[model samples]
Target: MAGHSKWANIQHRKGRQDEKRQRVWTRVSREIMVAARTGGGDPGANPRLRLAIEKAKAANMPLTNVNHAIAKATGTLEGMSYEEVRYEGYGIGGAAIIVDCMTDNKVRTVAEVRHAFLKHGGNMGTEGSVAFQFKHCGQLIFAPGTSEDRVMEVALEAGAEDVITDDDGAIEVLTAFADFESVKKALEAAGLTAEVANVTMRADNSIELTGDDAERMQKLLDVLEDLDDTQDLFHNAAL
Candidate 1:
C-alpha cells in the first residue's frame, strides 16, 4: 500500500498486442477450471469461481467453452488435472518477480520458467524468496480523473480496507479477499467501475528501474507471460 498502484503492471498487460490478447482466453479458461475445481462449480456459492467467470466474460470467451471447462473440472468430463505452482525470481537490478501458473506437468513449467529467467538476466529463487515483500489482497483501481470522494464513500461503507489517492491522482481501493466481491458489487451498484480489479499479490515496496535495467526486466516479463502455462505474473518493479 505504500508504493504506487500495481495498475502499471495491469496496464502493461492490458496493452499487449492484439495477437497476444488471443492467449488471454486460454489463461482465463485455466483460471476458471482451477477455481471451479477448488470451490465447486456453482458460481453463486463460490466467490473465486464468480470472479473467474467475470474474467472469462471480459476476455470474450465463449459460454460453451466456459461451461465445458467447469464440467471438466467438476469431473463430468475427462481432462488433464492442473495444479498451481508459484515461481519467485529476481529480474535486472534485483526486482522481485512472482509467477503463478497452473499446469499438469510441473517439471515442464519449472524448466520453461527457469530458462526464461536465466536467459533474460534474471535468477529464479526458492519458495518464499521474495513473497515476503508482497501482500495477497484485493485491489480495485480507478483512473486519475475519477471522482475520488464518491469512490471513497461507497467503498468504505461497503467494507473496503483502505482507499488511497496517489499523488498522481489515481484512486486505489484496497480490500481483504473476503470483502472483494461485496465491495465490487457496491461500487458497481453506485455506477462506479474500476479500470483494474482483481485479487493479487501486491508488492509492499517498489524498485524503480530505468534505462537498460528496465528494458531487460520488461523483456524477461514478456517471455514469462507468453508461456502457455503461465497464468499470472507480479513484480515490484516501477519501470
Candidate 2:
C-alpha cells in the first residue's frame, strides 16, 4: 500500500514489539479496565469494552486475566483505577507525535513523558498543539488480493464512511468512531476479515524523515512507548 495503512502500521509495530519484548498485556489490561469502568462490563452492550476484549484476544491475553480485569473494573473485585491522558509533542524533523496514556498518577505520567521527549531530541507541546492535525476514526485494512468490490459493497452497506484501495492493493475501510463496532460486526457477518482493525488517530499529512532524522525520531518513539503508563502512540512521521 502507501506504507501507511492500518495493516502496515500494525505489522511494523508488531515487529518492534517482537524485538523489544515489551509487556503488551500490561497495556491491554489497562485498556480493558478503563473500557469496562467507563462503559458497563458487558461487552455486548458496550462498544469500547467489546473493542478492548477483541484486542486482548488478538494479543493472546489469558481469558482469566481478561475476566479479572473486567471484574475489577465493574467492582466485582478490587483494581487500581486509571485515567486516560494525551500528550502532544514535536519530534526530530519537527514531526508531530501524540502519546496516549492510562495512569493513576497524572503528575508522574506527565513527568515521565516529558523526560522521554527531552532526552530523545524532542519537546512536549501544550495540549491541542498537534491534535488538530489528526482525526479520530475507525480503520480496517485487508491485505493485498482481497476483493475490493466485495469490501466496498459490504462496508458501504454497513455505514462505513469510505473505502480506499492503496497503491499496494490493500483495501482500507474507514468509518466514524461511533459506528466502528457495528460496521465491524457487519463485515464479519459478510465473511470479511480485516488484517488490522481499530480506532486510531489518523494524521491528515505526514513528514517524511530520512537518515539521521529518521533514526533520532525512532529513538524518541521507542523511549515514549517504553514508558510504563503509555497505552497507544500516534505520529505523523513517515519513515
Candidate 3:
C-alpha cells in the first residue's frame, strides 16, 4: 500500500484547519480564484473550478462569496492575481514534505517557505527532488461501516482505478485525476457519500516518526501550514 492513506494526510490537514479558524476559507478562495481564472468562470465546463466549488460547498461557504471569488477571477471585479508554486523539502527524520501555495508575490512566498524550513530543522530541496515519491491522484474515503460491496460496485463501475477496504473496514476509492469528478458524481448519485474527498499528492511510502522526531516533524508541518500562502501540504511522515 506504500502507506498512501494510512495516516489520511489530507483529512488530517483539513481537520487541523479548525485551529486556524478562517484560514481554511482563505485557502479555498485562493484555489477557487486560481481555478476560475485559468479555466474560465463556468464550473460546468471547468473541472478544476468545479472541484474548487465542491470544496467550498462542503465547507459551507456562502454563495455570495463563491460568486465574488469567481467574478474577481474572471475580471468582472477587481482582485489580485495569484500564481501556484510548490516547494519540496526534507523534514525531521528525513521525511519527504511538499508544500503547495498560491501567491501574487513569488519572492515573499519563497522567502516565507524557505524560512519555515530552515527555522524548523529542515531544508528545501530542488524542484522534483521529493516529488517523485508521490502520486497525483484522486482519493475518496468512506466511513468504516459503509457498505463495502456497494462502494466497490459503484466506484469500480464508474471508472475508479481501485477500491481498497482497510483492516478496520474503511473504504478508499482511487481514481485518475481527470476521472475524479465523474466518479464522485456517480457515487453520490447512487447515495454514497465520502468522508474525505480530494485530489492530492499521496505519498508512495512512509517514515514512521516517534518521540523527539515525531514532535519535531509535527512542529515543522504546523509552521509551514500557518504561512499565509500555503494552500495544500503533503508529507510522508506517519507521526
Candidate 4:
C-alpha cells in the first residue's frame, strides 16, 4: 500500500458536505441494491450488503430508506436498475485518477464523465491505463497521534494484513476484503476509531503536487466528486 497524504483525505472529508445529500443517498442506495442483488438481503449472509449498510449508517441515511432500498433489490418494490462503470485518467501533475460510478443511463454518464475530465485539465485514458497503479483492498485510516501499538495489536489479531504509519504519522490498517468487517469491529471495540474506512482502490505510489498544479488537482477532484452518478473517486496525488 502507498502512503496516503493527509491533506487529500482532509480535503475529501471537508468537501463531502458540499455534495448534495440526495446524490449521496442515491449512490449509497445503488450500492446497497447491487450488493443485495448479487448476494442476498440478509447482511449476515452477504458481506457486500453488510458493508453497504454500514456505509448507509455512517452517512446517517434513514432506516426506512435503507430498508426500502433492500426491499427493492429483493424484489419487494420497484427500482431503477443500475450498472457500474469505471473511468481512468491523468490529472494535473501527472497523477493517476480513477472514477467509479453507477448509472442506469450509460450514454449520459460517459458523456458527463468525459466532459468533467476535459474541462478540468485532465485527459481520459483507456480502461487499464491507470488502474495498475492501485491496489484493491480494505483500508481503515486513523488520524495522526493515534496509538500505533494498540492499533497494530487489535488489527493483526483480527486478521488485518498490515498496520502502517505514514510519514505524516497517520496510521493505516490494511485488510483483505473478506476480513474488513471483522477487523473494523475489533478496532472499534478496542476504542481505536477510524477517520476513514472503506473498501477502495488504494494507490501504490503517489506524486507530490504543489502551487498551481495542486490547486488545479483539488478543483478537478471536487468537480468529479460532486457528480450525481459518481460513487467514488481515487487518485495518487499528494496535494
Q: Top TM-score: which candidate number?
A: 1
Q: Which stretches of candidate 1 lie over 4 Å from their true place?
A: 1-8
Candidate 4 global TM-score:
0.94
Q: Candidate 3 at residue 209, lDDT?
A: 91
Instruction: Estimate, for each residue in 106-225, the C-alpha lDDT of model 4 and write its tens digit.
Output: 899989989999999999999999999999999998988899889988999999999888778888999998888889999999999898888989888889899999999989988988
Whole-model lDDT, model 1: 0.89
Distance (Å) between predicted and true CA of 184, model 2? Answer: 1.4
Q: What TM-score quantifies how close candidate 2 is to the native fold?
A: 0.92
**Which residue runs of candidate 3 sit more than 4 Å off their true CA positions?**
1-12
Please give the distance, in angstroms, between residue 82's alpha carbon in candidate 1 and its true position after superposition: 1.0
lDDT per residue, candidate 1, 1-239, as tens digits?
A: 33364556657778883457668888888888999999999999989999999988877789999999999999999988999999999999999999999999999999999999999999999999999999999999898889988999999999999998876678899999899989999999999999888999988888989898889889999998899999999999988
Please count the clashing residue pairs in each candidate, in the order shown. 0, 1, 0, 0
Q: Following a full C-alpha superposition, what root-mean-square deviation does model 1 have from the true structure?
A: 1.6
lDDT by residue for model 3 (1-239), tens: 21233535545666888666578888889999999999999999999998899888888889888999999999999999999999999999899999999999999999999999999999999999999999999999887789989999999999999898765567889999999988999999999999888999978788989899988999999999999999988999987
Give the TM-score comparing model 3 with the true structure, all chains together. Answer: 0.93
Model 4 clash pairs?
Answer: none
In model 4, state the lDDT of residue 18.
Answer: 36
Local distance difference test scores for all models? 0.89, 0.89, 0.89, 0.88
Clashing pairs in 1: none
